[model samples]
Target chain A: MGKNNVEQMILNIPSDLKYLGAVDAAIQDLAREFSFSPDAINDVSTALVEACSNAIEHGNHFAKDKRVVVTLRFNGGDFVATVQDEGRGFDFAKALRDEAGPDPMSERGRGILIMRAFTDDLKFKCDDKGLTVELTKLRGGGGDAGQ
Target chain B: MKITQREVGSAAILDLNGKLTGGPDADAFRDVFKSLLEQNKKHIIVNLEKVSWINSTGLGILIHNYNTVRGAGGDMVVMHASERIESILYVTKLNLLFKSFNSEDEAVRSFTAAR
Candidate 1:
């Protein structure tokens, strides 16, 4: 792990959902530091963007005063992102993938499925404090991401 | 984010570029969508290749446009979506709601094809 690699930065933002771009910026900076390929960086960025949105929308329900804490860490060989929320967590097995039918008609409900598809590792942890989503994507690895 | 609109062959093609994460981008998208409705051009094709990311508000704007246009006997088609953006569209099941194309030309062609 590179010592100067940010190795960690946590930012807490209001659960307003409107401030998602702030999360996007932080992710971009962390991803770029690894010299990730344009396409690779794009994959992680897109997944993380949707993850942050779900944290605010589904987990926190856009409650303005509530907060979502995002932890970013870029080690030499791996990129890890953790989005923590104070709201209740969600069910993964019960998730739906109707967005894959093609023809581009469905208008909502697709963030988490996309996160799992793009990132190498996706997990949801729900305890008394609330929910924490940990996503891990390796740097410079072929992995299972589709182009 | 910036949404620029133009008319091509009885269709309204909105070129959406930049991040659309519900801040200024969301309102800007709404204003643009509203202007298009006022202009009476209903069949729409949105170019989202340059749009890297968006939150729920951005997706809601699409729903708003879809409802408005369909009410006017027109529908919205999406064209030239980058892969990352396409994932968002797919996960949201919007792929069924919008007709997406590999290029703007293909999307424009679909207006007549779908008919």
Candidate 2:
């Protein structure tokens, strides 16, 4: 059932900011193949950049030995992407609570909020190994693909 | 992003072309803003007309610079954000933080009109 209709792709990028452009281009191409609207493509692209940036900066600590892996899958008209890092995980619950506060002028902490706002579903997984951020976007419409 | 700066009265207009995503410490951007601050040009206008895309890191760069300028008793504004970039700002509520203008003239006028 999983392989029947779902197509998946993976990208592994070194913990360097320069590779973010390639990540965005790859996600844009995948979104195009799925016929996501222009707005949807933009949201996904921005979210992917944020997730990958966080992985490279926070999770991988910009260490050349570390790598960030991105997996993208289109399943039954919905898109799912995951960004994984090799460093210790962070406090996802605290990050979410901070985003819920009313501090629009704050410079930091908005990356996760933007990802959560754009994607239908956002989940963070942490273990002794590392951190992984999962993002989902449903077909059609703009702004948070979930109804 | 490729950034070019010029003086519009006391305001510094930064014209950015290309995606304003990750770079090595985003040095290119940081350098330009640093120069502006050194020159005592606190009021800044970032022209995003040619920028096709931006992400959280890019936004963070802008916000970081914004605070720096504000701390120095100056300010920063953005103009000509493409529809998609505007959407990112709106989603993050950054649209409320950095004042936005539709045209370079309007942005320049704003800085001069303030003082």
Candidate 1 residue spans exceeding 4 A from truth: A1-6, A96-106, A140-145, B22-40, B55-64, B67-72, B90-97, B101-106
Tell me each candidate's TM-score: 0.77, 0.90
Candidate 1: residue A45 lDDT (0-100) = 74
List where candidate 2 sits over 4 angstroms from the true fold.
A1-4, A99-102, A141-147, B22-25
lDDT (tens digit, per residue) of candidate 2 on A21-125: 898899898888877887788788888888998999889989999999999998976889999999898888888777563476665677787788788888999
Kindly report the docking quality category of candidate 2.
medium
lDDT of 1 by residue, B1-115 (tens): 7778788888888888787666456577667777877887767898887886765557767776687788878778888887777766665566667778887777777878878
lDDT for A84 in candidate 2 is 96
Winning candidate number (lDDT):
2
Distance from true location, Cα of A51 in model 2, Å: 0.6
In the range A48-146, model 1's lDDT, one tens digit per residue, is: 777787888788887887889988888765888998888878665455334242234344554666677668888888888778888888775543445
Q: What is candidate 1's TM-score against the reference?
A: 0.77
